[model samples]
Target: MKGWLPFAGGMLAVVLGAVWTLQGLGVLDSGSVMDGVTLWAIVGPIVAVAGVVLIVLAMRARGRR
Candidate 1:
């Protein structure tokens, strides 16, 4: 229960980041301002990576206990 927060947050971030990346790349149009935005294209992958890192850290911490 204690470790679920980061894991859940990370999962959400990852999913959102993927969507943002696709939208920014003009691959997944959603009729939003973020669509085809260059900044989101760049930022998306970074956010996704951060989320992955968070997930990994959370898993590692849980494993050590």
Candidate 2:
């Protein structure tokens, strides 16, 4: 279970990263995803940062225990 944490985080990062990136890049057009760069620029990076933090935490947790 512990070992799966990073994997899950990475997977989430990949998925969300793709979505946010595509939306930011104009590949996806769903609601605010294409409303403006503001949403993607701000929210996307924030979510991505959170995903990275989770991955880092998971890695550290695994290393400790």
Worst 10 residues of 2 by lDDT: 33-42
Show model 1 residue runs off by greater than 4 Å.
Answer: none
Using lDDT, give the best candidate's number: 1
Angstrom error at residue 22, model 1: 0.3
Model 2 segments beyond 4 Å from truth? Answer: 25-37
TM-score of 2: 0.62
TM-score for each candidate, following the candidate numbering = 0.93, 0.62
Q: Tell me, by TM-score, which candidate is best.
A: 1
Question: Which digits, one per residue and each the tens of the lDDT, describe model 1 over residues 1-65?
Answer: 66778888889889989998999999999999999999999989989998998899889878988
Question: After aligning candidate 1 to the native by TM-score, how far in Å is the CA of 49 from where it should be?
Answer: 0.3
RMSD of 2: 3.1
Error of 1 at 33 (Å): 0.8
